[model samples]
Target chain A: MKNWSEKTLKRIWKGILVAVLLLIVFTFSPWVLVKGKIDPILFSMPYHLWVSILSTILLVVFTGIGGMVFYHLKLKTDPNANL
Target chain B: MTQYLLLIGVLYVGVLFFLSLRSRKEIKTSSDFMLGGAKIGLILGFMTFAATLFSTFTLMGMPDFSRNNGVGAWIFLAFSDAVMVFFILWFGFYLRKRVGSESFGGMSRLLQNCYQNKGVGYLYFIAVFLFLVPYVAIQIRGVAIFLIEAFPDFIPVWAWSVFIVVVMLLYSELGGLKAIIYADFMQGTLLLIVVWLVAMNCLDNVGGWSALFEQTANTQPDLLSPPGPKGLLSPQFLIASCIAIAMIPVTQPQLSTRLVIMKDYAALRRMAVAVGFFAILIIIPTVIIGLYGALQYADASTSSFLGSVLLREQHPAIAAVTIIGLFAAAMSTSDSQLFAMGNEFRGLIGSKGENNLTPIRIAIFVFAAAALLFSLVSSNELVLLARLSFSGTGIMGPMIILGILAKKPQGSFMIGLSAVALVIFIVSQLGWIPQQIFNMRLDLLLMILLSLGALINYYVKK
Candidate 1:
C-alpha cells in the first residue's frame, strides 16, 4: 500500500511539473503565428483583458505547483504521511 | 433611485440565501467554518486572497487617487504589494512553521505560550478586533455607496446595504469559510474582467496612452507629478506610503488568513508570487483609469456629471459588465470582513466548542448595521477612510513583528506600543498634530518609534 501510494504521488507531481512548464511557455510567448492580420475573434481583445486572462492562468498554474510541493514536503516530514 | 437599488438588494439577498442553504451541511465545527477544515486547495485559497485584497476601495478609490494625484499614487500602492510579497517570501515560511495556529489571533496564543502571559494574548486579540471591525465596516460602507451610485434604478443605498448584509450573513453563517472562499473565487474572476474592460474602454475613449499622457502634460501637468496640487507625493507622502505598506500586511485580516489556509511553505511562496503579480495587474489599470478620468474631465469634481457619466455612460453591452465588476469588488471584501469579524466576535464573547459560531451571526448583523449607520451620516471620501484604516493598524504592526522575533516579548513592551500607537492615532485624528511633523509623516514616525522601542526592549531583556 505504501509503495503504491508513493508511486501515485510521484506520478501526480510529475504531471504538475509538466503543467507548470506548459503554463510558463504559454504565459511568456507573445508571438501569435497567423497567416494574416490578427483576427478579432481569435486573438484581439483589450490589452488589459489579455493581461487579466494571462495573469489568472499563471496564478492557477503556480498554485498547482505550490500544492504539489506542499504534498511532497509533508510526505518527507511525517512518519505515516500517506493516508 | 431607491426602486432600482431595491432590485439589486433583492438579488444580493437571494444569492446569499442560496449560498447559505448550500453551505449548511458543511459547518460541522468551528474549524470547518473558520478555516474550511484546513482542506482548501490552491484555487479557492488564491481566489479568497484576491477577493479580500480588492475591495470597493480598490475598484472606486484607486481611480480616484490616480485622477487627483497621478501615477505617483499608483506607484505608492504598487510598492505596498511588492513589500508585502517580499515579507511573505522572507518571513511567511518561518511564521507558519513556528506557529501552526489557524488565525492571526492564534499568533497571540503563540505569544502567550512564549511569554507565559495571558495578558499579552488578550492585548493582541483586542487590538485585532477593535481595528479590524472598523476596517470591515468601512468595506460594507464602500459597497453600499457603490451600489447606490452604480444602479440608481434598482438598488437604493439603504436597501442595498441591508441586502448585502443579509447575503453575507447567510453565506457566512451557513458556508463559513468554504462558502466565502468559493464566492470569493467567482467574484475575484468577475472583478478582474470588469476592471480590465473599464481600463480598456477608458483608454479607447481617451485615444490611448500617448494621448492621455499628452493631455495631462498639456492641460494639467501639475496633476501628472508627485504631490500633485495637494502635495500628495511629497517626501512626507512617500514616507507615509512606505510605513502604510509595512503596517498593512500585519493588520489586514484577509492577508493574515492566507497564512492559516496555506498548505505549506511552498504554497505560501507560490501565493506570494501569484498575489504580487495579480496586485500589479489589478492596481495599475485602475490607477490609469483614474488618470484617464482626470484627463477627460480636468475641471470636473467627483460629484460632477462628468465623473458619473464617464463610468456609467458605457455601451449598452458593457453596462452589465461594469456593474458586475463593481459588485464583485464590493462583495468580495464585504463577505471576508463579515467572516473575520464573526470569528473575532465569537472569541470576544468567550464562546468555544461547537457553539462558538453562534455569536458570530449576531456580530455580523451588528457590524453591518453599524457600517450602514456610519455610511448614512459620514461623507468622508473612500481614500480618506482607507488611509485612516491603514494608519489605525499601524499601532499593532510593531507588536506583530515583535511577537514573531521575540521568544518572549515582555508584556510591558506590548502595552507600551499599544499606548503610544493609540496616542498617535488620537492626535492625528483630532488634528492637533500637524499633517507633516519633523519633515516626516505621522504614521512613519509612529512606526519608527514603535520598532525602535520594541528593539530596545528585546536587547534589554537579552
Candidate 2:
C-alpha cells in the first residue's frame, strides 16, 4: 500500500512540474512576444487581444481540471500519504 | 437615485450585521475566532476565497488599469490569478500535512515551526506587517475616495475613510473570520452580478464586443495593444505583475489561512477551481468596461472615467447597487487583512492564548486605527498602489516556499538576507532608489536574488 501511494504521489508531482514549466515557457518566455498586432481581428477583437483572453481562459481551465483530477484520483488513494 | 441607493446600502449593512451577530456566538476560543474552527465547507470556502481575492481592485482598479494599459492588463491579473490558484494545491497539502490539525496560530508561527527559530519567525512577521499594513491602508483609501466621488455632499472624505475602517472592524469583531466569510459570499455575488450588468450596458452602448474593439481602434489604436498609449504595460511590467500576483496565495497570511481552514483536501481542491473560474468571469467584464472608457472617456481622469462608466452611463438603480457592491468588495478584503493581522499578533505572542480573545481584539483595534490614519495620508493611484502591495509582498515569496519545502532547518542566513531584501524593496518604493535595477523591474530582481540565496542556503545546510 505504501509503495502504491508513493508512485501515485510521484506521478502527481511530475504532472505539476510539467504544468509549471509549460506556464513559464508560454507566458513569460522572453523569446515570444505576442503583442503589437492590431489588424487581424479574430471574432471582433484584435489578434493580440483575443490571444490574451483565450490564453487566460485556457490557463484557468487547465488549473481547474488539474486540481480536480489530482485530488479526486491520486490523493484519494491514501489518506495517510503526505501529499 | 440617491435616496434609493441610501436605502439599499442600509439594507445591505443590516444583512451583514445580522450575519455577524449570529456567528459571534461561535467564538468560544481564539482559534474559533481567528479561523472559524477550521470547519469551512467547500461552497462557503470558495465563495469567501473568491470574494477576498476579487476586491475593489477588480471593480475600480482593473477597468482603470485596462483603460490605461491595454490588453497587457489581462496578462497582469487574469492570468496571474489563474496561476496563483495552482499554488494552493501544493502549499495547502504540505502545510496541512505538517501542521496536522494543529490550530493555525499565525503564518509567522508556521514559519517558526518550520525553521525552529523564533527569530526567523519574528523576521517574517515584521517584514509582512511592514508591507501588508500599507496594503490594507491603500484598499481603504481607494474605496473611500470612490465613495467620496459617488457622494460628494455627504460627510467629508476623511469621514468616509473612518466609516470604512469602523464598518470593517465591526464586521470582523462581531463574528470573526466566519462573519467575514459570509459577508464575502454576499459581496462576491453582488460584485459579479452588478459588474456583468454594467459591462453588458457598456458593450451595448459601444455596439457589441467586436464593434467596441473597432471603435476603440479607430479612436485609440494604442488601447488595443501593448505598452499602451501611456507605455505602461511593457513586457517586464506584465511579467513582474504576473509574478507578484501569482505569489499572493503563497505569501498572504489571510489567503494562506483560507487554504488550511478548509474542511478537507477535496474541499480545498474544489474551492481552488471555483476561484479560478470566478477569476475569469469577474475579470473579463472589466475589460469591456475599460474598452468602453477608452472609446468614450479618453483623455479623462481615472476618477471621472470611473464615475462616468460605473455611474452616469448605467441606470441610477444599478449605479446605486454598484456603490453597495464596491463597499462590499473593500470591506470583504480589508476585514480579512485586519483580522489576519490580529491573528498574527496572537500567534507571535505564542498560542497559549486560548483565553486571550479580548487582548487580541484590542490589538486588532489598534491596527485598524493605524490603517485608518495611513489611509488618510496615502495617494489615490489605485492600480499602482495595489501593484506596490503585491510586489512588496512578492519579494518574500521565495522565503515562504523554502520554509514549506525544507526538510530541515536552513538556518539564520536566509533570515538575514530576507531583511536586506525587505529594505531594498522599501527604499525603492519610497523613491529613494531606481525603480528598475539592472534593467529589470526591482520586484522581479529581488525575487531572483532571494531564490538564488534560498538555493545556496539549502546546499549549505546539507
Candidate 3:
C-alpha cells in the first residue's frame, strides 16, 4: 500500500477550488443578475423565480451526486490497507 | 380543536419522556451523555443535524421572510444551505481528524487542545455564547409569538416562552445530547409532515403554483427579484448571509458536536448530502407558504400573515397538529443550543478535568432560563436577529478553519486576533463603534481580516 501522494491531495484541493468558484459565479455574479432581472414568466413562474427555485434544486442534486462519487473514489483509493 | 391540540401535545411529550427514559441507560458516563456514546447511525445523525439547522427559523421565521421578501428567500437560505452542506463533507472530515472521537465537553475544549492556549477556548466560547443566547431566545421567541397568535385567548407570550424552556430543560437535563438527538428525530419528522401538508393546502387555496406566482408577478413583480419588495434581500446582503450561514458548522458548537458524534466519515458524508436535500425540502414549502401570503394576505402584518398561513388557513384539526409541530421545531433547536452552552460552560469552568457534571446541569438550566427572559426583550425581526447571531459567531470561524486545516500547532496569534475581532463585533453591535467599515459590513470585514491574520501567522510561525 502507498500513502496518499501529494499530487493526489493537490488534485483534490483543485477540484474543491473550482467547485467553490463556479458556485460563487453562478450565485453572486452577472449570471444571477442577468437572469434574475428577467421577469418573463416561465413554467407558471417568473424567470427569476424559476431560477431561484430550479437553481437551488440543481445545487442539491449536484452536491449529492458529487459527494457520492467522491466517497466512492476515496474509499477505493484509501491508503490504509485495512480500511 | 383545543382538545385535539392538547391530545397531540400530550402524545408528543409522552414520546419524548419515554425516549429520555430509554436513553438513561446509554448515558451513564459523561462521554455517553455528551455524544450519545459516539454511535449515532445514519438516520438519527441526519435528522438531528437537519432538525438543529432547520429550527423555528424554518417553521415560522422563514415563511414570514419569504412572504415579505418574496423569492429571494430561496437565495437567502436554500442556496446558502446547499453550499454549507457541500462544505460540510470536507469540514466534517477535517474536524473529526483534529478533534478525535472523544466528546471533549464542547467546541471550546477542542480549540483549547488545538491552539494549546486556554485563552483561545475562553474567547471562542465567549464569542459563541454571546451569539447563541439571542439565537436561542429567538427560537423561543419565534414560536412564542406565534403560539400566542394561534391560541391568543389562552397563553401569554412570556408564559409560552417559559413553558418551552422548562420542557427543554427537563429532557435535556435528564438525558443530555442523547435525549436531544432522539427528540430532534421526532421533531424533524413532525416539522416536515406538518409543513408540507399546510403548504399543499396553501397551494390549493391560492389556486396552485401558477396562480400564486402569476398573481404576485402581476400585482407586484418586485416580490420576485433581488431586493424583493421590502428591499431586505439585496445582492450584498444575500452574499453576506451566504458567508455567515456557510460558516455555521464551523462556529456553532451544537452542529460541530454533531459532526464529532457521527459514527464515521461515511455516515457524515451521507448526513451532509441528506441535509442538502433536506434544506431544499424544508425551504421549498416555506416559499410556497410565503407566496400564498403574497396572494391572499399581501398587505397584512407579519403576525397576521403567519397566523393566517400557519393556523387560520388550515382546517382546525390540522392547525392543531401544526402548532405542535412548530413547538417541537423550536424546542428541538433550542435544546441543542442550550445544551451546547452547557457543554461550553462546563469546559470553561473546568478545563483541567471532568469532576463536576452538576455544575454543568445547573448552568444548562440557567442558560435556558436566560434564553426565556431574553426572548421577552429581544427584537422580533427573526431572520435579521438570526443573521446577527451567525455573523457574531462567524468572526471566530477563521481561527477554527485554520485549526482544522493546519498540520501542526498553529500558536495563539490567531486566538488573540480573533478575540480582538470578537470584542469589536460586540462593541459595534452595542452602538459603541461604527457597524460598517469602508461601506462593508463589519462582520464581513472582520472575517476577511481574521482569515488574513490566520494565513500570516501560519506562514510566519510554521
Using TM-score as the measure, the top candidate is 2
The worst-scoring run of ten residues by lDDT in candidate 2 chain B lies at: B351-360
What CA root-mean-square deviation does each model show from the true structure?
8.7, 2.3, 2.7
- Point to the candidate with the largest lDDT: 3
Candidate 2 chain B superposition, TM-score: 0.97
Off by over 4 Å in 2: A1-16, A30-32, A72-83
Better model by lDDT: candidate 1 vs candidate 3:
3
Per-prediction TM-score to the true structure, in the order listed: 0.78, 0.95, 0.94
* Winner on DockQ (2 vs 3): 2
Per-residue lDDT tens digits of candidate 3, residues B38-150?
Answer: 76788999999999998888888888888888888888999999889888877876787776645567788778777777888888887887788889999899888888888
lDDT, candidate 3, at B266: 77
Question: i-RMS, every candidate?
Answer: 11.3, 2.2, 3.2
* Model 3, native contacts kept: 0.41
lDDT of 3 at A2: 28
Off by over 4 Å in 3: A1-13, A34-36, A69-83, B350-355
Give the docking tier of candidate 1.
incorrect
Q: List the residue pairs that clash in candidate 3.
A: none
Model 1 quality (TM-score): 0.78
